[model samples]
Target chain A: MYSVEELVWNDSFINWVRYNKNSDFWESLRASDPAVEENIRKAALIVKAAAATPEIPVEESEAAEVWNRIRRDTAEPETGNRKWHWAVASVAAAFLVFLGIYNYGKTDTRVSYENLISEVASSDYKEIRNDGPDPVSVSLPDRSSVVLYQGSKIGYSLSGYNREKREVYFSGEGFFEVSKNPQKPFFVYSNELITKVLGTSFTIKAPENSEKIEVIVKSGKVEVITRKDPRKKKVLESKELEEGNYLVENQKIDLERATMKLSPIVKRELTELNHAVQQMKFDFDEEPVTRIIADLELAYNVRISYDKVKWQGTKLTAHLSDEPLYDKIEMICKAIEAEYEVRPDKIVIK
Target chain B: MTRLWRSFIAGDEDAFSEIYEAFFKILYRYGYHFAADHSLVKDAIQELFTDLWRLRSNLSDTTSVKFYLFRSLRRRLHTLAGGEDVYQALPLSENDLRGLQTDSREQYLIDKETEEIHLKQLGEGINKLTTRQREALRLKYYEGFTLSEAASIMNMNEQSVRNLIQRAIISLRSLLS
Candidate 1:
């Protein structure tokens, strides 16, 4: 008969206790050695108890928050020295030039906006056409909102909108407020330029007849890359774009159709024409806490719950434009001497 | 999981997120065990994933993603904790004992009144173990990793890990009696 410690240390016994595996073998052993049955039971209990060690619970919101930080950190272009891949790429490019076979591998994979739309026309893509005189709002399946300008159109696969990735094809001008989802990147394919973001508000102007497609970043980081180049087609290249081609808050990138070149412009003055999402003022001067909370809820598309009666007369005065949504909440909570808990679906202020 | 890792290495954003979702909690729990600091553990995990993403091209496929992440997070937490000895024995807090009791009661589906006293004693006995002993038991029995896998994670020989666990169980039995 095996000792309790021997049974406890056995891998098969542990597996059986934890997952109910190898039951036949365990049952035969128990039947053959009835004297070891008690030892077996005790060992199983020990394994179960050991596995039941209390774990630090990680809330869904907490995981998402950390993920957002990771996404943001990784999305930023690696500062200083070119990454190894770029070094290899440059060396290979130079070698190709030396071999005089560069032009032989140059294949033009560019497609027009009309062709792109027609290709998706047969699919079950939900197409939103703004025939109205003014810009109309379009809400996507992933809670991302798009303000489609007159004579503009946006289409996305209804089935795959938020499942794998949030992808949308657009023509003409539109202001996009994409919801934060680091796992599923938000992709806006407009003309020759594709603007990718984890979660950010931006404006894409890609008129069907315009020579230049523009991406204006109102807030958060935005990556604009040429849609035609297969080498740079992978969304992972957002890291590479951070080095040279990515757009940050208040910056803009204009993609020339003729040359397929990206020119990033640092716009100091964000006019009303380009900065659509930034119109919502985050700077508050003695604003009622209720109003400020409502604005935050509207801006971030998150619900903030608290005792209305307790905070009826609370007011906030702070410049929150430069801070992230969570930081802004933290600052507000600090001013009010309150603690905020991030739940799965909502933020609770106590 | 291997498919997801391969896709992540191939620059698939969705796969990267999938891997993160799959491993975040377990990594968090393991990191917490190493160091109780909430933000510190969170930062270690965050940096671990960030580095993984940054060096994804250099990473090879692993059959056991959990073991790989656990090793990475352990190394990271060790460094972030300023090279403090993670094997050093730590006094179990009252909260930990209470948490153990509740967890065991819920997991075993046993008669609560009858098992409470015994489970409490078991928890105390388990808690009295050295951090190394607890970690070895945790990796072997709780996580269900193979002996060699646990030894590798603990940076010790398999026989040494086996001895540590045997000693831990003997001590627990003595304490229980």
Candidate 2:
């Protein structure tokens, strides 16, 4: 049997050979080797058998018609449980058809809302309930993510998706991994407070009275502004919070200079920096040998062989890539009052 | 929809509806593949399309409707499949699901052979690769995207994409030969 390599490498020639059993590409070669041509023809037979199975059809009408029926029944304004299945089916049909065609030409670019809107539509907003004690997750249309906390109700508008903004209404707590969109700012409405972000990973807390609305920045910076604040009707008291920062109400603002008073936004940049340092084996400006040895061992999976008397009190300072461990080890050895040699997988200090 | 795409971008409802009708199936099918649930899939596809329609004015600048549909399908599928934690859904045992003989290796072979005979062999050679390989090919070929684009979507390094494409073409050439 021909290998995957042979078949894939000359796929065009093979295909050409398969379709035109006696094409020139093969003619020149086949004249010298009839067996290879025969093999190529036989491969074509196998390929034909596969294609005969049926190409997944791209239908515009069935999906469209399903949605049409859904729109018709749903528009009646008196839909019951009976209509729900059919409505859901129509939406499913539209979804499947759209998927088959869309994946047919897998795109590399992120799909824009405008482009997404043009491709398809369905009318079904079925609730997904997870009874597990753990958090239940629900993904939105724009590729952002939502982890619904226990006992929460969030609804989406599929049919009326092509609006000015992409909004999801949530009645409880949820963490969001929002897909980035410079134009369409994602809004999560909870407890009379609407949190808007471009693209970020954050947990939204909308507890009761002392239940403050908190936006914890996980990765990207989020501009959490009051969507409906009486104080700034046009634009709420907005603050740009970075990673490891908290934006909340009633928090005291640091009055900087007369022109710039820090808002209620507070960032614990130091905390994050400290945590990052904890992961480091050695981050030292003073005695560097111990730290260097610890980091080098972790990097190269090797043990150090050095005299405690010679290297005990030695220290050095350097930034390691944590990659290409040997290079770092060499740099460290040169910096110190010692030298080193690589023995198989292990490094020995001399 | 009664109006054309241009009209929809102009904020015409009729044109928006027409665009919706034309592309609804593509979105729904892709969603079903990803979500594997009828109701969840439907709601996602519908919501995405409706959202798109509402923002039809922005559609004026886009070139291909298909690219938009696929991209949306991927996003929605990621949502249904567990968002950031997509690997949560493990591949079902053959007995658990349809038990159809859809083994990756077998599919790879048949798919490659079929492409060799029917589709452009060079293209098929590129197509009949691992899902990752095929995607890398599509980004490089069909969309003319930079290696960076392929890497971002595949969530791999740009250097990795370059290496993958290079290897894919080598394999393709050998198959053709």
Candidate 3:
């Protein structure tokens, strides 16, 4: 018979119990010394409870942003000594200027061919995951952009077919802001469905272990088509989607309601306008809290507050990065000689 | 080994990211438990990973990459703490200072001291054994190597690995109790 302390600290016995789970020694030990074994089990329970609880330490997204900046800074220009093995001068630069001239009055309906070309990756594509509440930018050669959400993978052929029509595949979920180019449409193949859109913003997801492909548009229209389906014969009978707004491939089309908001014209207009605004850029030169808060409100069109109204006068003047909506608030508060607590929907200025 | 070595050495960013991602959490946990500073751990892990990437050409002779990483981390921790004093004393906050007058900070200090004592106890318990015995325990438990793998890694016989593990556990039990 062992004392409670003796049995609890028995490493071999504990290891045996930890690994085997239903070992006979535990039963025998419990029978011989109930109190000791009970303590051992209680201690195990404490360790197990601590292990089970997820303790995520919160750090500012500054680390991630810094890492990104480092990676970008290290690319090509910064590392002039190291010649880029796969680097090619992107035509997206020229395309941007062309679009600027072409879209003087009209909304640019053409997603830049340059943006489409940018998607032509040279490296072997593999699974990508972004496990944080921030947007991850992947530049396609055509200057089209993809923002992968928290847990998503975007796979594409980088070697054998890299220069071709930019064939890329995706699974899980992601948002795409395609550079407008009417000549070459951007294609995202997932599961059995293919989403083809020319110069538009949209999201597509084909979750693991699920058969359905979910396509949702935030800006421009997308045509979803079935690549391989038993119902292909039926689909071939008619041009299933004569610009019928939104669609689900291989699935029955509810021909009744096809909604179209923000026509191609309006979308072009908005993109041009947004692009110009993005160029103008916003800077706060180490301004006071009150001033920064006012600037942020004007920029993002959101209201901000401090723990005390008097705290507003506290000053902060730092060049703000293109941070997420909430992080900006946090930074503003931090600058102003105060801390801000985050609420579910808003920030509590403290 | 040569194939993976070549892939990594060729500046394959994906390969680097994959290896880094797999060991990142474990390294982070070990670093956090030892250094008690998050930023320091992050920096150490980054340095470790970059070194690993640079030294990929030598991977063929090195078996048990996980063991190598742990040993390196331990050495780094030892250097960071400096000399023999293991525990780091963190600064007290304004709230804690105020609580000291009310005896609350004293209570917290007591609890923290107790936790530090247990952590030291655990470390010392493992340290009591011979190098072989300690290696066996570390490989089997922390690194999750099988008995045969541990034997292979330690370049010892299988029975020797088992015997060493058993002896190490018994010694730790005595020390811990």
Best-fitting candidate, measured by DockQ? 1
**Cα lDDT of model 1 overall?**
0.67
DockQ of 2: 0.04
Candidate 2: docking tier: incorrect
Query: Which candidate would rank higher by lDDT, 1 or 3?
Result: 1
lDDT of 3 by residue, A105-219 (tens): 2223222222333455535554456664443545455656555554555755556322434445665555565655655555675544556655554544444434233343333
| DockQ value of candidate 1 | 0.19
lDDT of 3 at B111: 48
Instruction: Judging by DockQ, tell me the better candidate of 2 and 3.
Output: 2
What TM-score would you give candidate 1 relative to the actual structure? Answer: 0.49
Per-residue C-alpha lDDT of model 2 across residues A1-350, encoded as one tens digit per residue: 34333543354554553354345655565446656645554444333322221112445445654554444333323335332212211100000000001122322322222232233333444344434334544556665655555555455567643254556655444555565564666565543344555554444433222123444443344544333344433322233233344333212112111222224655323122111111233334665476567544432224454544467687677654221334445677778756777542235677
Over B1-177, each residue of candidate 2 has an lDDT whose tens digit, in order, gives 222555656764434455665666645543453445656666666666666665656664444555565566567667667764231122222232222222453343345444434334433443355655555654554343456765665567999987876676566555544
Evaluated against the true structure, the overall lDDT of model 2 is: 0.45
RMSD of each: 22.6, 26.1, 23.6
DockQ (CA atoms), all models: 0.19, 0.04, 0.02
* Structural similarity to truth (TM-score) of each candidate: 0.49, 0.29, 0.33
Q: What is the overall TM-score of model 2 with all chains considered together? A: 0.29
After superposition, the stretches of candidate 3 with alpha carbons farther than 4 Å from their true spots are: A1-94, A98-350, B1-12, B60-62, B77-177
